[model samples]
Target: MKAFFRGLVRFLLKYYWLVILLTLASAGFSYPRMIHLFKTISTDPIDLLPQDYPSVQTLLKIRDKLKPKKSFGVVLESSDAEAIQRALYDLKARFERLPEVGRALVTKPGYAFFDKHKLLYLELEDLKEIRERVRRKIQQEKLGPLYISFDDEGDKELDFQDLEDKYRKRYGGDQTGSEFYVSPNGRIYAIYVESKKPNLNMAEERAFQDEIRKTAEGVDLKSYAPDMKLYFGGSTRVMEYRALVHDL
Candidate 1:
């Protein structure tokens, strides 16, 4: 090993200039190639994993074959119930007519079915209270006929306004109508918008959402509902919704 090192040192000393020139020439030749490789190198973390790994294969399958269909919501909000309802229906119809929209569902179907079966959903305590109210109403009717009063100052007859106030107090007065699409407070409404385009990539999905926003802007929302605000909802905007609310 000592002899080999001595011989190598002598050789390097004899051709040191040639060795330096060769080294410079090699570096000059390889510099551009190295830069190109660096520029084209994959930065994706998934690309670092071996293709044969189970997790990598699963992720690739999800990215290529099992991509989920994207959908979003268009939210309409206002203090005026009538205006909001009218605008919601109009907007829903317009969205449905768009070529990109697969479907725009607003009001839920089967109102009669839910109305008929709503009693089953009431809690035991609530049902008991309702039964008591019914009993009291029945007793009042029965006793009213027997105790006929000659004076006008007797118990006043129940009128529409009285019944309205009674029920309005029993239930919440904030609700706009009996529709399930409107929020409980009657200030917010949502239209579910599904995409018609198949296998939308990220860029295509963003374009679709932009188209929806444009369609909404084209409509004369102020004419339909005063002080009404439109917003985007669903998976895409959910994270940013809080920021939007703060801005509003």
Candidate 2:
């Protein structure tokens, strides 16, 4: 064992320069290819996955076919709820017109849902007010051939409490009517920004993210609501967030 150890050390000492030379030569030969590969490689880790994998193949297929949408969530803070509401609606309208924006649910989905089923969601007083308004409108119009029908057979009627409970069970969130837009305290507001394209390449995805942030920043919340503060959240929000946080 001692003799073998001595021989091994001497052998290693004698050829150390040759080993170093071979390593340098190998690295020199492969360095350009490594650089090229690095340059061509995608930043997204998903691109690193084997294309032949079943999960990857399925994801690619679904992405190409269905184009699953992604969104960025935003939070706005202000003391004035009315101003926040006005700004929020204006912002939503602007987002709808943008080419890159698929949609902006600036107003809570629950509110819209509740509004569609207002008869079931609204308070008795509110319902009475609505009936009174309808009566007044009819009287004001003074139509000669007005036909009215209160059909109950077609309507699957349920008590307001039962309907409200069902709605709460189905779509329960702070984003529901009276609670939508402004938070319960009337300080915070939420907005959701969706991308126009589901299957986005790296550049397109970055551009979509940029558009959301840019749109938010361009709004000039001060102009819309002087006290309001806006910031973005959600998947792409970190990138878009740079502008909101920095500008403020």
Candidate 3:
């Protein structure tokens, strides 16, 4: 063995340039396969486990049985509440018109039902206070311009504006007057956009997000609010992931 290794070493030293050329040629041939493997690599933790593992089988079963809907959020921001409201509605309408969008909800349908029954959630004392305020408002409207009292009793008449301000202070935290999802200062709104199809393939998911962005570009948000900006969130990150994998 020692004699054979000595002979091999002598031959390699004599043909060093040829050895280097062959090494480079082998790497050149393998480069494409390396690139292909990188692009097709799986980053999922579940994929790291053996396919026959009990946990892996159970997880696969669960995933197959309960696939989640593909959805993303479109956020609208502006200093003007009126602009945000108008743009929110307009954007929602445009998203709904898209063939890729299953539905766009500015506010969930359940919100309307709960809003109608909100008074039922109030306490007895709160209900009584609301009733008294309503009665005073009615009296103040009926009194009209002819009512005058010279008595020293300092009875202040009810002001609807004050009541409205109080109402806003109580229940309008981070929400607009129309009760849409908003930032704490009421300068931003969000619209939930769900895709019409499932997220079965990364390419298809990218296409879905691309279509949404295209639809948004068609609308002039500045027309509704000068400073209004539109953004996307949620599963839209998948687009970036797919782009990175493709570039790999």
Number of the top candidate by lDDT?
A: 3
Model 2: how far is 130 from its true place, Å?
A: 21
Q: What is the TM-score of each candidate against the true structure?
A: 0.53, 0.54, 0.61
- Tens digits of lDDT, candidate 1, 1-248: 99999999999999999999999999999999876654434423355688789998887778677655567778888898788788878888998898889877777666667667866855677667667656555666889767555646355543345444555566666342365467777788887777887556444666778788898878887997669998887454333433443453
Q: How does candidate 3 fare on TM-score?
A: 0.61
lDDT of 1 at 45: 39
lDDT of predicted model 3: 0.74
Q: Which stretches of candidate 2 lie over 4 Å from their true place?
A: 1-46, 108-173, 178-182, 234-248
CA deviation > 4 Å runs, candidate 3: 1-66, 123-173, 176-178, 234-248
**Residue-level error in angstroms, candidate 3, position 115:** 0.7
Sort all candidates by TM-score, best to worst: 3, 2, 1
Cα lDDT tens digits, model 2, 1-248, are 99999998998899999889999999999999876763444534357688898888887887778877777777789888878888888888888788988998865566556577767856687678557656655654565336343544222222345445555566654445464555657799887878887766545666677787788888788876678898877464344434443453
Q: Where does the lowest 10-residue lDDT sum fall in candidate 2?
A: 151-160
Q: For model 1, what is the C-alpha lDDT against the true structure?
A: 0.71
**What is the lDDT ranking, best to worst?**
3, 1, 2
